[model samples]
Target: MKRPKFFYLIAGFFILAIFLAGCAGQKGNEQGKSAGHPNVLKANWQDVLSQAKGQTVNIYLYGGSESTNNYIDNWVAPRLKKQFGVQLNRVPVNDTKDIINKLVSEKQAGKKDGSIDVMWINGENFLMSKKNNLLWDSFSPKLPNVKKYVNQNSPAIKNDFGEPTQGVEAPWSQAQFVFTYDSNKVKHPPKSAEALKQWVKQHPGKFTYPAPPDFTGSAFIRNMLYETTGGYKQYLKPLDKQTGLDNIVKALWNYLNAIEPYLWRKGETYPESASKLDQLYASGAVWLTMGYDPAHAANEVKDGRFPKSTRTFVLKDGTLSNTSYLSIPFNSPHKAAAMVAINFMLSPKAQIAKSDPENWGALMAIDPNKLSSKGQKQLNAIDRGKATLPSKVLANHRVPEIPAGYVDYLEKGWMEHVAKH
Candidate 1:
């Protein structure tokens, strides 16, 4: 029996709709599941060591510091090669975004293996990569050296901004926001927002921060928000969502508005990154700079990047503290090797070496007391700049970090307000 014309047309239309829907669903599924596929080359540490014996693992690391690069080449790579027979290839990047961009490009090209073996990061970048399904999951627990040297309960073992690392990313170095000023230039530094404003007006063009999206820039903004909002003392917990946005954030905006024009470059432009801010200080363009790596300035001084008279401090308030972590890309060709690298990074010997002034001077992930006697001696022997901002100063001055979500929101808002203007 032949169907009526309308019935035939409706049947054809329905069939086409179903087929299109199925295709759309398949695409969505593929996109969702792309970050996970057993076909991806992952191996246990021993297996990876065997496979990579004399092979190279491209380690994408932030390369702003010459000492850090040297550490990788002279120290980390040599040790890995000597012990594990793995050749480490350092792919230095100025920003973690570079790696993210590369991973994205690789994904777009459908290149599955032989990509970046390991990357160093933490905070928003880690979350962004994880949320986008850009990184491997739960490989931290499987490293050959996971059981050694690290205390899983420490803040360093966790992700930046209080995010759960979930063993997807291995913990690397600890860092804190440190404020540094030229002792010869600024005899008495301002200790608070009100004081800082007066000081900035007195010393225009002598202070500036790295632009936002850089960790230090965002950290400055976070500290300002914390102080103005009076919620800094409680920053570790999730923010109060029940509070009305306007009511809670009103003071913060007001504080920023008041201080915006007074910032170096007259609120117009900011240094591109924290390292550039250090350069600005070295050039006498800015008297002050901040770094997430607390010992950064000291390292700079030791290397002649800054005057030896330059000293680091926190505000009368404590400096912002956070950890930088190592994460594995979901498509990492050698997951086990990446894991081994991260684990090695967390070892006491590595941490101590990383903290030396000639090195990166990043704080150790493990507690100082838990370190071996030699490790403690090494940690103590390092000057780490004088801790002039005493425990009381830090305790009383400690401000809260904004919710992680607010960081991105504020960046967009700050751009729209300041950048567009």
Candidate 2:
């Protein structure tokens, strides 16, 4: 049946509107493709290098250590700028949470371009960022240095505190738990967690840990848990509220409670952070301190903060060891430049320079076995310092980290069962 002209005109208008809307949606999808997804750079290596030229990559990292800051600012930054024509802006953050919070806020606001290009992170922070979809993905495998030198199968490389890294972050350096003591004061240091308790009892007010939630303190607690329990094997899987709190962490609380009265300040107070605990050790107020970095004692001694006789040791059973990583934010504005910077960091030259005790004193994430003979020789030439424990000793006594979920539960339990009690 033939309709009126007005009806036919309205029908034609509707058809055109529908077609336009479809075209607009297609365009939007195409735009999204061009913008690039996380870790999926649409460009090849040369293209990426070209795109990164003249770009500035802002790196956010914990600013607790002057030496680390100096290494990046003086050595890394200069090399990046000279070689890649990229500007390196090191943004010092008191804590990594500040960076995460900012990223979350930016995501909530739908900000497409973010300020943070790269971040130095690991452990629970890495887990949190990955879980929240705040990090880019799977880019480390593409980096030439990582592909050639990194031991991809190593647990230290594959996991961050038992949370699978999944290539979301590129390993920056390795760390292991170590106790530092003034050799003049401690003729013989505790060789195990059990011995540590007796030592604490015998020399009251001479030892203490930084409060939990501080990175080093949390590690110290986990190390204790491993020693108290049979091993860290049971904590290999993901944890839940019930099992994590009730079964897994119960023994840790008991141990802490038993040793609490012997802690510095008679268990009434504790150092707020690792640096504070270091201060106590430096001032001769405490005989022993602890940290995740094996070379930290050496670095402190070099800085004249720690006594020249300061020495580091790991427990007989083992000490926790893990790799820290540098990750890009999901909304990073300069993905290529960030990748360039991270790739440079993984290079043999950078790793060797970073491992020097005079510089950062960080363990290289790159495997020496994978490097050329010259590179191996260079790594061997770096002095690990008198205070630093030998790499072979560290490797022999290395332990794996527990899952990230268990961390907060343990920290809270410490407060409830040991701190408050």
Candidate 3:
């Protein structure tokens, strides 16, 4: 009897231990096993949007163009106010390089918060900012507006000028190489690089590009390299030190050298900047000029900056096109507001409004199909210019691009070349 009783007691003890073990396993799952996760806060976009509703966001942008400044002030800013109660104060700078320098200084000073809210950046500036850890972390996936409204396939979303975005910046517009000519000045326009050089020679002091490091100047060099190299496959890759400069591009340099003597002001001087070149074009100092904005002439004409006789065109080869994006500083105090503003910019309504020629005249940053039916109609209405080149024009065009690696090296080489002569 005593042995049987002891056996029963042992069975009960084992059962209790098993039950407790199961309970312990259940508790572990409920609490979650990760040591670093506190599970204290919920990642919520609604909360962020609410917090940002009335906040002020300071945006730093390239202020080189008067028309752009006016558009931002007259159109984009007021809408942000009427909708979100957010106030935007634009900090205009002549050079984006200065903004980077300021950001670097702020970071070094240990001023972590309440610095800059948003930045308008692309190309070399975007790459350098991302490399230096100046930009804010990825907030794109967290925004409802981004998930539902933004066009994921647009070049703006792909990354600007071949640089990866990593969701650190929101895309705003599409820009392509646009060559504008005044019909009064030239009855026949050069359709190829070789022809352009000949035209420059035939009409000395009629053509010029911005100096190196400038957006247009750098792009022009890249375009020339692309054409002369015969293809852009190798250039689209990272530039290597071994072949830092391609001998194939010698033709481009030769061509440019030959035309420098005939360039505007004898190529001893340039228009100082891309905007100045546009001004030169408008003032009839130069018969032709290059623009990244295809509809730039339309805007200029609408605003009385360019005559109606001016027309825009692209080379037979489609132009090297890209997008511009907005980024936030790593230490932005109003990050939520910045993200909200970006989402709003990406929204269909705001995007359509921005697309209007009378407003911002910016190209849409979304796919037309994804846009609301209403948005699609708005896009169609605003995209008024001839968007394609004729077959004959296409044959003369070259898809020129600079290898990311060659950008700095080429700029340096070009500077040296300029200095020696």
Can you give the lDDT of residue 360 in candidate 3?
Answer: 60
Residues 1-421 of candidate 3: C-alpha lDDT, one tens digit per residue: 3577889899999999999999998876544322111221134766666667777888899886665677678877888888887888788988887888889989889775645789888787888897789987776666666677676665346655567788888777656776888877788888678888889999988899998777788788777776666656666656553463556667767767878999988988876678889889888889898867666677777778876778767755456766677888877777777877777777888777776666666666655568877767767666544432332353244353443556787778777776356
lDDT per model vs. reference? 0.70, 0.88, 0.72
Candidate 3: give the clashing pairs: 239-405, 316-393, 316-394, 316-397, 317-397
Report residue 77 deviation for candidate 1 (angstroms).
1.0
- TM-score for candidate 2: 0.91
Candidate 2 residue 221 C-alpha distance from true site, Å = 0.9
- Residues 321-416, candidate 1: write the lDDT tens digits: 666677788677665556556667777777788877565666666566677788777776766655223323443544434446667866776566
Give the per-residue lDDT of model 2 (tens digit) for 263-289.
Answer: 899878989999999999999999999
Runs of candidate 2 with Cα error greater than 4 angstroms are: 1-40, 241-248
Full candidate order by TM-score, most accurate first: 2, 3, 1
Please estimate how well model 1 matches the true structure, expressed as its whole-model Cα lDDT: 0.70
Go through the candidates in order and give the clash count of each.
4, 0, 5
Best by TM-score: 2
Error in Å for residue 360 of model 1? 2.1
